[model samples]
Target: MGKIPTTIPRRQLGRRLRDMRQEAGISIQDAARLIERGAGTLQRLEKGEANRIRMLDIQALCQIYDRMDELPGLLELAKVAASKDGEQGLWWNEYSDAIRDDFELYVRLEASASKLTVYQSEIIPGLVQTADYARTLGARYFSDTSSREIEQVVTVRLNRQRIITRRRNPVEVDLLLDENALRRVVGGPKVMAAALRRLADLPANVTIRVLPFSAGFPLGVACGPFVVLDFDRATGEPPTVYVEGYRGNLYYDRAEAVAQYRDTFRTLQAVASSPADSKQMLRRLAREYER
Candidate 1:
């Protein structure tokens, strides 16, 4: 048996594919044989119960299910699922932290993504947060959580930051911050000041944009916080979108929602400051907050 992803993104993608198949009015047996797998196997995959997916098998299913349009999206999830090595359950899970649930798929997808576009409505994006700043915020928000565990989480987030420029394929990141992130006072003024300096000091490729309260909300704001990750086809040939929320994450392979979010993001981009101006704004906030 293969390992299952303990996170929402992986399962959600599989669920979307299954829904699309049923909507097309295809029977499970036809899909299974077409994908060159057993009926039960196809059924399991559709239910988000499958451990791993074979590439040729997915291609076969895509053809039979009459979803040549969606084959690529399923392929990307296959790549993500393959990278997962089941983690030993962490002690911090006693509080049932939401981030813990996302840890596995978060790493796998980040590793594979060619470009990551993020809109952070509150707090610094984890990729750019300073250790003390992270510790302070994590400690407070996770009030019941012990300092040791919080420290471990801070370490994990900081460690993940190194992926900004990995050797073989340097990941590209475009992070948009709400102005509050720079002014929220997570670790008090001093800690906030240091955090801003760290954000300014990041490597050149990582772009930080601040959406000031003055911008008065862009198209995407109505939907709430979401990160859209772009993975150029590696083994699977289609791009996939991951949307997260408090309840769970949603993966969109359906044409409609994907198109809608893309349009929404484009609207946000239109209202956002240009790259040069964004950097300057971040620098200004850092100085302003310092005083």
Candidate 2:
């Protein structure tokens, strides 16, 4: 047999399937009948259970849901999920020792989001976090672990961005970082300086802005840090909000919660500096830290 690709994340297949099924408004029995599959089997797929995912099954499910664009990536991940080597976990599996189950779901949603807007309160957010910086936070805040494991997680965390950037249709990223996050010394001088420089260097598709301390506490202070995931499920797929508390991240698909966060985000943007000023701030921070 030809070698099976093993790079895919564990349960990623099921996660993607479940998200799409939920977004499409497909129920267990409805999807089962349309795909010529059993309801229990469909449930397992949606539950992130380990299973052999046939390309034909994926094709049928997508067609039933009328999601033609997702077919290619879905088929690719399915084949990898079925292969022997694919059974092995990605680098993220190591962190599962302390990571909450719901956070894993957040990671899955993050991977598939067409657009992401993050409001960071305490420190620099993960996507732009440098290796040393991520480790410092992981060691200090997360359950204790050795340096090697922390580094592995840092790698996976940074590499996960590849999912959006790699595709021909690059994901749109809007990062709103509080001014204090830039000032905080999570990893001390050297690491923080490097992280700031990296943040300033992000590409065109990625928009990084700073909510200045002068803005005087926007909506996020009460709400704290949250991630807003915008997906184009169909021609007009509304956005969703994902909030991570101390314990686990919660997915908010309810129209009311989504609407609340949406207005709050717009308020934040209006009060915060323009993109030009945001970049200027990052550049100024980098210069200050370099010294």
| Most TM-score-accurate candidate | 1
Name model 2 segments beyond 4 Å from true.
1-100, 234-238
lDDT of 2 by residue, 1-291 (tens): 112123223345666777788888988799988888899988767554445566787888888778888999888767655666633544455566444565666665565567988888778888778888888888876556677766666776777667445646777888888888999887777888888888888877888888888888666455488888886554133466888778655667568998888788778877888878888888888788778
- In TM-score terms, candidate 1 sits at 0.69
lDDT per residue (tens digit) for residues 9-70 in model 1: 45556676777778878877877766667888877676455667677777776777678888
User: CA lDDT, every prediction?
Assistant: 0.68, 0.72
Candidate 2 accuracy as TM-score: 0.67
Which candidate tops lDDT? 2
For all predicted structures, in order, the TM-scores are: 0.69, 0.67
Task: Indicate the worst ten consecutive residues by lDDT in candidate 1.
Answer: 1-10
Q: For candidate 2, give the lDDT.
A: 0.72
Q: How many clashes in candidate 2?
A: 0
